[model samples]
Target: MSKKVENLLRDICFRIKVKGREVLKEFPITPAQFDLMQKLYFAGEQTMTELSRMLGIAKSTTTGLVSRLENEGFVERKRRKNDKRIIIVVLTKKGEYVIDKVIFKRIEFVEEVLKDFDNNSKEVLVSLLEKLNNSVKRRGG
Candidate 1:
């Protein structure tokens, strides 16, 4: 039963990822760049070092990704007020818009897939998923 549940969750995540990539096709960004933007969007502004650590990539790679995002007007680098040497990467309005649109499209896809589910079933599913998510967090997953 647990194995079946795990497989179902994995398959659902894969489908969502495929849908996200399809949405990304309409944007002018790569998966890596989108990932960086998502991190910035959720975690707020971060230094290149912090981003590299969070993304598990090298500083040089983060720098390159930031450069491309900056060129595309999706993000900007600004020096900290107290320290001119510390550069923080900030997501621009364009970056936020991209993230918002991608998430909205993903939600739309999920809604379409669940259209046949009754309201009570949907509510119960949400409750179970929330419980599962809390359990995963408790396990440090």
Candidate 2:
């Protein structure tokens, strides 16, 4: 039962992600860029090393990603105040705008997908998902 539930959850997540990519089709950003931007939007500024670790990618890969984002005016890298060796990245105004639009589009798509659900059903779903999320966090997932 647990394995079935896990598989179902993975399938659901993958579908949602694919739908999100579809929603981003009109935008210049890719899913990878969106994921990185989303993290910055929620997690605030972070060093390149930290971002790489969090994204489970190599430092060089993170640098390449940041380079692309920077070139597109989506993000900017800054040297730490006291430590020039440390590079912290932050989203630019353009980056924020793209992220906001992408998020709104994703939410709109989800609303359409969930339109058949009643308010109570939606609320219950949210509650259950939150519970599961909290449990996952507690278990270090």
In terms of lDDT, the best-performing candidate is: 1
Per-residue alpha-carbon lDDT of candidate 1 for residues 37-72, written as tens digits (9 for 90 to 100)? 999999999999999999999999999999999999
Per-residue lDDT of 130 in model 1: 100
What Cα-based lDDT does every candidate model obtain? 0.94, 0.85
Least accurate 10 contiguous residues by lDDT in model 2: 18-27
| TM-score per model over all chains | 0.92, 0.87
Which segments of candidate 1 are over 4 A away from where they belong? none
lDDT (tens digit, per residue) of candidate 2 on 12-124: 87876776667567667877778888889999999988888888889898888889999988999999899999889999998888778766767877889889999999999
lDDT of 1 at 72: 92
Model 2: lDDT of residue 70: 94
Model 1: what TM-score?
0.92
Model 1 error, position 97 (Å): 0.7
lDDT of 2 at 89: 97
Instruction: Please list all clashing residue pairs in model 1, or write none if there are none.
Output: none
